[model samples]
Target: MPKSIVVPEGTSKPIAPFSPGTLADGVVYVSGTLPFDRNNDVVHVGDAAAQTRHVLETIKTVIETAGGSMEDVTMNHIFLTDWANYAAVNSVYAEYFPGDKPARYCILCGLVKPEALIEIATVAHIGRP
Candidate 1:
């Protein structure tokens, strides 16, 4: 089967040259998603917890739209600019995927938007067309 791109309708628009997620061979490879709102504005600019929640929700929307769920996520790639916000980010993340968590790797990195405190990308096992 040919690979297909999944662009979530209600999530923030991509500010770069990448799709929200790419579906190929029953897997959805999500790009690094920034904490932007529907208007493409940075959300909760300085608040890591709030920004973390927003980004996760946005990722959820994209995964669900492509016929998957948080439970279907095989891996999550979490990116952050500062290590100081680690605890806060993890707190919010725990609330979202409390059980059967996916494999993940968290790393400190520089993001495109300076105001973005957290960015999350994922790989989900989508089982539908």
Candidate 2:
């Protein structure tokens, strides 16, 4: 199947060699996203809740740019630098997906950037069966 890159307006140029998202076979595969500013530096520093909000907003943009919405998301891969931030992350996360939460798994581990407390990659199906 053919795939197209999804780069929404104002998206920071990724520090790595990867598109922000890829659309293939009616599915939008969003790359792991961090809470970053236009300079590619981690934002919200030590605040996990703010960081989670930023990451989710980034993913929301990518998905919407690919003709989908948060409601279309099927799964999410969440990563965190510390387990203690789990509640903070989830509290902000619930605001994004208030109903019919997508399937997800959270891992307690290190991120590419030391100040980045959260990273989220998402999958959304936007095509009909």
Candidate 3:
């Protein structure tokens, strides 16, 4: 199958040049997402948990837009500006994938939006490639 980009109607616009998600060969790849609102303004600036939750929510929407689900997620890449917020971020993350957790790698790095506490990207497989 040919590759297709996924962009849910209400999600925040991309901060840079990248699709919100891409689907090819039955696999969906969500780009690192920030906690921004429909107006493209950052949300939950000071609260790590809230920011993480919103980030995952954005990822969920993108994957679903491509016809997949959180259960279909195979892996994720987490990017945060500070390591100190790791535990708080994980607390919210556990709520999203309560049963089958996807393989995840967390990285400490500054984000394009310095107010964002976390960003997440994912790879999901809905079926055979």
lDDT tens digits, residue span 13-89, model 2: 89999999999999999999999999999899999999999999999999999999999999999998899999999
The segments of candidate 3 whose C-alpha lies over 4 angstroms from its true place after superposition are none
Per-candidate local distance difference test: 0.88, 0.94, 0.87
* Top-scoring candidate (TM-score): 2
Rank the models by lDDT, top first.
2, 1, 3
lDDT tens digits by residue: candidate 3, 66-96? 8888999999999989989999998999999
Task: Look at candidate 2 and tell me the lDDT of residue 4.
Answer: 93
- Pick by TM-score: 1 or 3, better one: 3
Candidate 1 residue 37 C-alpha distance from true site, Å? 1.8
Could you give candidate 1's per-residue lDDT for residues 24-104 as a string of tens digits?
Answer: 888999888888877778989899999999888888988887888888898999999999999999999999889988899
Alpha-carbon lDDT of model 3? 0.87
- For model 1, name the residue pairs that clash: none
Q: For model 3, where is the 10-residue window of minimal lDDT?
A: 9-18
Q: What lDDT score is found at residue 64 in candidate 3?
A: 84
Looking at model 2, which ten-residue stretch has the lowest summed lDDT? 120-129
**How would you order the candidates by TM-score, starting with the best?**
2, 3, 1
Which of the two, 1 or 2, has more lDDT?
Answer: 2
Between which residue pairs do clashes occur in model 2? Answer: none
